[model samples]
Target: MRFLSGREAVLKHIFETDDEAPLTPVAVTVTVTREGRTTAATSGTAIRNGDVYTFAAGSLPLGVYTVRWDGGTAAVDTSWFEVVGGHLFTVAEVRAYDADLSADRFPTSAVVRLRDYIAGEFESITGRSFVTRCRRIPVELDGSCSPLPLVDVQATTFEDSAGQTVYAVSVEPVGPFTLAEGEGSYTAELTYGFRSVPDDVKRAALLRIRTLLFAERSGIPDRATSFQPAEGGTYTLATPGVRGSETGIPDVDAVLGRYGFDVLDDLAGVLL
Candidate 1:
């Protein structure tokens, strides 16, 4: 069964008789567990439909869930499934972003890849996600860290290696602060990420996606490509243009430059 993260999973079970016929009016027990916690447990009867007895779950939460089925006697069955999130942008949106382009410019499959690639880059560079989901997130820091690297932090725990609690002294939704000035980790349990994509970022992503796709189709290297001359093996020739900048596309770098900080400097605190 296909499961989407942050969504429900519907499971269906079918049973047959010794003669390979439908087992009608069979009673079965179903249980679902996650992280060693029982989330769902139910007993029901699967009335024969056409040629087979079919039992199914109402729905299960997103995660690796253990599904158990017992049909009395010695017949027991267990299985596993996983849930993952979908693309950040749709194929249609990619096309709409560049109306001058044709339908065949970027195929549905290519669009899927590009959307994910762009979203990942956004988070990696900005330290923030365009998609919004209410879930737990862990924030990390290094020594003498002045600015917090993440944003939209609702709550967090500052702890040391011994699991000792370290007071923040000051905390904010987006922060760059001190955590006892020692080795520790922060496990944040709160709603984070962007619920909506900013117009500028969206535009910049589309422009970059288009630029890369066309360059790939033409067998030409985009701005990120690097060259190493045989004569100068020790020295590498880096691409002159910037990633979002110098792409011959206006406002791409302009938007990225502004959001880059939003990803990096969300938190501002004086180091003590």
Candidate 2:
């Protein structure tokens, strides 16, 4: 299961005996862990509601969390959940696109998985980062103009080899337009990536997600091909798979075509 960050996570488990009857243990305990570190734990009979045990894990940061339920039974039930800062599309947005979709028929977890999958696929196909990030990168300056091999550059601060801020540097639309009067190595505190994802990109992602869901629920393989005989021709229908930089969906492919670029194109053949 997955949840957005800053949202409370409610974990529940049903206890049953070997005879297929409700079994309420004398006591139940819940433990929440992240990266093998226990973050929260609770033990008591207060957590039990009849045969159902629940633990309300408070708002957690972005990361995977494991939940363990110890009901004094011979077996320990374990489950996992994830928290993300944001997604390209929200569950509400996805449901808006498909009016027939409902929480009962299609859960939010399934939708989150599909959204995450499409987001990753879009980034991989376009060779671009959609999430804003900051990092320190090594750069070589020739005392003049030097292009920073990064995309969607928002801001940068250049520092000399000794890690001192270089005041004699100016950032241009493309990269560092000017640098200090010397040839040497420098580090750049670069902040880059999109503040908001493109509308068309989100639309393409929605379409692809819808296609996948429809195929899955209808028992149809996405890659399955069928041929129909017409009065004067044969029509072949098939779903396109990801090839090269294409997503196989017409609208998706069109959107990606506008943003996709070869690695060489991104670097402009600059070795650095």
Highest-TM-score candidate: 2
- Quote the RMSD, in angstroms, for model 1: 10.3
Point out where model 1 deviates above 4 Å.
Answer: 1-88, 99-105, 133-149, 154-186, 219-250, 262-272
Candidate 2 RMSD to the real structure: 7.8
Candidate 1 least-lDDT 10 residues: 263-272
lDDT of 1: 0.53
Top candidate (lDDT): 2
lDDT per residue as tens, model 2, 1-272: 65666688777777656799767776777788763244463333327777778778878754567777776654467777766555677899989998877788779878877877776687777766564444467877777665666667676777776667886666666331222244577777766556677788778888988887776675544565544445666544434553433655677788888886675554554434
Model 1 steric clash pairs = 126-263, 147-176, 148-175, 148-176, 175-267
The global C-alpha lDDT for each of the candidates, from Candidate 1 onward, is 0.53, 0.67
